[model samples]
Target chain A: MRILALPPEAPPMLRRLTSGLRRAALGAGALGVAAFAPQIARAATVHVTVAYYSAATGPYFKQMAAAFEKTHPGTTIKIDVVNWNNLQQVLQTDVSGGVPPDISIIGTRWLLSFVKDGIAEPLDSFMTPAFRNRFIPVFLKPGEIGGKVYGLPIAASARALFYNKTLLTKAGFPNGPKTWNDVIAAAKKIKAMGAYGFGLQGKEIETDVYWYYALWSYGGHLMGANGKVAFDSAAGVKALTLYKTMVDQGLTEPGVTNYTREDLQNLFKQGRLGMVITAPFLIGQIAKEAPKLAYGIVPVPTGTVQSTYAVTDSIVMFKASKVKKQAWQFLDFLFTKDNRVLFNKNEGFLPTTRAVAADPYFQDNKQLQVFVNLLPKAHFAPVIRGWENVAKAVIDAVQSVYLGKAQPAAALKTAATSADRALAQ
Target chain B: MTASARRAFAPRMLIAPSFVLALFIIAYPFFDIARMSVYHVSRFGILGGFAGLANFRRIFADPVFIATVWRTLVWTGAVVSGTILVSLPVSLVLNENFHGQGLARTLVMLPWSVSLTMSAIVWLWSFDANHGMINATLQSIGVLRQPVQWMARASTAFPIEILVGILVSVPFVVTIFLGGLSSIPSDIYEAARIDGAGRVQQFWRLTLPLLRPFISLAVVLNVIYVFNSFPIIWVMTQGGPAEGTQILVTYLYELAFRLGRPGEAAAVSLAMLAILMVFTTIYVRMQMRSAEP
Candidate 1:
């Protein structure tokens, strides 16, 4: 309660007014407490903030929440869905404002910062061995920092090359290009036939990830043992040079720097581009929007090593949560086999739970199986703080290279220096 | 107290409520940002130990910050001056007692009613390389053999953004100028004609001098608005294609949210606030001095 007392030296009318205001304040405060009493005394609400993966995300979570509420009558669930682009900003504001939700779905790359800031609650003690065994280890590893688990994998995905079969057949490599050289050769032939050979994504979110497919394929790594940026190595330059060459030779679509990952996918769906690399969610998008498109999946083209980028978004328990027990129970119920399978199927994400992986829906899907088989050779984002800053630097470098403003080696070197400075902060 | 002082105190007491509201609304955030700029803050704005001037030093050392400062100045100057030059002729024509003047005025101000972000998105689509109306129109007129990639590089993109800035800013300036025009009473042009002044001379001598205060007001307001404009750059190019189109406000956004360095972002913002304050002070003082007898 606020102290509304006036000083003893106040005049008669002022003191009278102050006392009257105090009485009014007391009356309103009493009414406020009365209004909130039932909320505090009855069912507890576990508020969850989730990222909108698709239109189905909100309704799917609401359905899960309702089912959980029915099973556990004493606890209520509240779900708030945010777009992926604004999730980080919203969470930061909510956390700093001291009203963070009980649970949130956050990018796995951000787990380190949350752990470092003591905002994430470690869920190891809350988990029994059976609960621990439910998750596939690879998917679970990203949410663990040091020796404790701070998040549970809610969704996981990996990237693969989605090649237009018709265009590839016309270019005489019908099964899709298996290597970078093959891609270039097929692209040249496709360009002669009045279509873009490769759909290069040179803009916006995941632009750096798109390039990392090439970098990892060519045996480059993100960070060294000392936790410094090492992407400026010889292999990194070579990988970038390969893309720059493609851009220069007109093998890619015109105005390559204007093409985001979504733009490239749109081109591929229109049959104007021969190949693009993207996640499995494109399969769902293609089915809904471009049903007549004939496309085949392949692993990211091979350089020195065949690799893909695996990523996950996880549900984390915040340290600020008051209803920890109820929140943990909700989390436990949400991760059940049926719930996992439903979420995976609705969002077109790869399975994160062991039981969901073995389900016939995922097991029988051939296009999904390609992504699953590539998982063993997938490279996750390195566990480091300030990874977004590094990605921004790399995205800038890649954009400049594609735009022909700077050479690949100089751009990578400049990016490495700036990224290291950002990482140092 | 003296009687005159007491008399002064009454009006001050009457204004106290609104004054306190303004203080709470404006000064609190100003003070908060100032404190954060001087302190060591975490990504989520948790203040750590006091680290004097380190945040300022970091931003000063950044090449992007320096480059963005100049770009912001260019953006402000171009947009503000462009708006004034465009609105002078527009408001002049609209002020004439011609038929359909109301409809013409409404058409000129239509873009103002649309939100800035919406206009930016429409322009983004308009300038799209593959399927934009601008390119189609140009190609149809036989202006080019190929469609131009307008947003691919900053060289073309920044100028287009400035044009859009000028377009959106014209309506408000024209409104101010129209108010100024009507206030001229229409008798001044008659008096100038009696003195043998030509039409251009009357505009130069009478119309411009009477419109001085309004021009100053428009410039000050637009400089502040255009300098802090976010969506025009953010929604269009996102200060991208290799940081080529970045301005201070957009760069500050990138710093605070994308890079998660709210402390340095606070420093950048405080720097921006100081710069605006200095500019407005100097400009207003100059205007006041030039207007003096």
Candidate 2:
């Protein structure tokens, strides 16, 4: 259409118009490709859904997901942080609904149930000997149900006696209690100083576990060789009586039946409680929430044996998950030395891996050292079906005894029956 | 289309969406629950074939379930009756010509506007043995020698739970009663007065009979709501201190969600539904009777 030939370099406006058209065409082409890029990438991307409980540590999960995505390129990790109280229900519901997440961080006690239900994927194929050896054996043992590894311990905690150092000193004890009797005596002394001597969690959720710390200390077990509840033994009665005596003597806080583990921790953090038995998570919380309050951690006072509750949350892959390999990758990423150390340090959980535990970050800390040393002596709750219901029965019995509604021997006997019933169910 | 055809199809077309919605939302789930009640559903919700009436038999045989049923009945009766009693007086006061009457009516409705969980939490704080306002005030005034652990003991917990239920429920009942009170013509009261009726007589003879429909409605609705109420007991006591306050709904929740026994939970739900249906039938009968001349 060039009726009139122009110079090689045309008018400024015309040059600009040609260049603009060229740029627009290029931009359109680029935009078209850009628009389809995500779709194409998404087709290749492996979507892994990770469900865990830690409302407080949600941001850390997002960070971990982002880090995983960045390194893995065409992969995505979706994180769901369910409330700890509702994790089991939600996970079960999700599993039943056939839309379960690819990976789930579940209570260690649930591993057997999940395995028995056939929803949990065996991770032995993914976990090599080197990788298996990386984890602390005790923490890893719960994840193994019947010689098949269904889960990996992602976070763990060992219950220990947390004493308010200032309160203990104020009550004429410079250090923490050395024995159960010392605890009672110090508690009485602290109560005289206008603070609760012992903060007992008599409520449902962890009440049974708290009772176990005492029960196991007295060399009692939840089940015997025949797999029946053996908690009605003399040791169990003694354990219940210990708590009952403390409450009756006004050494523990009033309304012990209403106190949750967290509530007791809060009371202790406020310097109003002389001693509490809880996990190492409280150390981080107390350091952050109550920095001015000095505290000490020790193994739970021995009755006939030295024992504490060792609780672990494990990560397992769902059998229905399509991206098992990618899920394993993320799981492996989570337990890597640096990530494990950082995550545990931030989340106030004990490291599941030996490498992380051996890190100076955990070694040099005196408060964490007590819990770390107690790990070997820690006892997990019986990993039996209907343990939750059994625990509820024990909680009821303990609460009744604490409230003086029943005698320890009778309550323990009844609780034992109830536990047996629950086990049989 | 012909005009006749269009007219004939119009109503059905207009109602089709809601009908389908009701089918999916209400009928489907209800039938599913009914089916679940007859089967042995596992923890994974796998139906383990027909269990016949075993679930129902087991629940009925269980002493705890029997206790829960009785508790549920007691909870419904006490809460509904308490609501009516408290609301009737407040609604009457609100209906009268008085200073701050509008403000009083609004204030009376405040608790109704708050969600049950929020109110339960507020009440939880108030009933805290050591730091709750009720305990603190009672102790300060020497009414309590020590801070009584209200929710920690079954005896005290049950009453406080009922009281909290009434607290949350009374506002709704008051508003309903107020609506009923306003609808009654003043002329009837005037006529009663002209016939030598005192204020008490006028209220007793005229106000009550005329408000019968509303009172029945309030009672029926309150019965359902209080029967199905979960939060007040859950947040306050968690049906605890030995499952003392565990009613039908909380027990169902524990059975289904906590214990992972959907079949048993569904049985409990069906039992609850049957009991509620009886009340519903009575309410409908009363409504029909009231509607007639």
* Fnat per candidate: 0.67, 0.69
Per-residue lDDT of candidate 1, residues B1-293 (tens digit): 99999999999999999999999999999899989888877767788888799999999999889999999999999999999999999999999999999999999999999999999999999999889999999999999788898998899999999999999999999999999899987887898899999999998999999999999999999999999999999999999888989999999888888888888889999999999999999999999999998
**Candidate 2 residue runs with Cα over 4 Å from true position:** A1-56, A170-172, B1-21, B282-293
Q: What overall lDDT goes with each candidate model?
A: 0.90, 0.82
What is the TM-score (0 to 1) of candidate 2? 0.89
The candidate scoring highest on TM-score is 1
lDDT of 2 by residue, A190-213 (tens): 988888998889886888888888
TM-score of chain A of 2: 0.88
Top candidate (DockQ):
1
Worst 10 residues of 2 chain B by lDDT: B55-64
- Which candidate ranks first by lDDT, i.e. highest? 1
For all predicted structures, in order, the TM-scores are 0.94, 0.89
Q: Which TM-score values does chain B get in all models?
A: 0.97, 0.92
- The sequence of per-residue lDDT tens digits that candidate 1 reaches over residues A1-425 is 23554443343345446646755665776777567444434667687889999999999999999999899988888788888988998888877766677999999999898998999999999999999999999989999999899999999999999999988998888999899998999999999999999888888899999899999999999888778899988989999999999999999988887888889988888889999999999999999989999989999999989999999998999998879999999999989999989999889999999999999999999999999999999999987888999999999999999988989999999999999998887
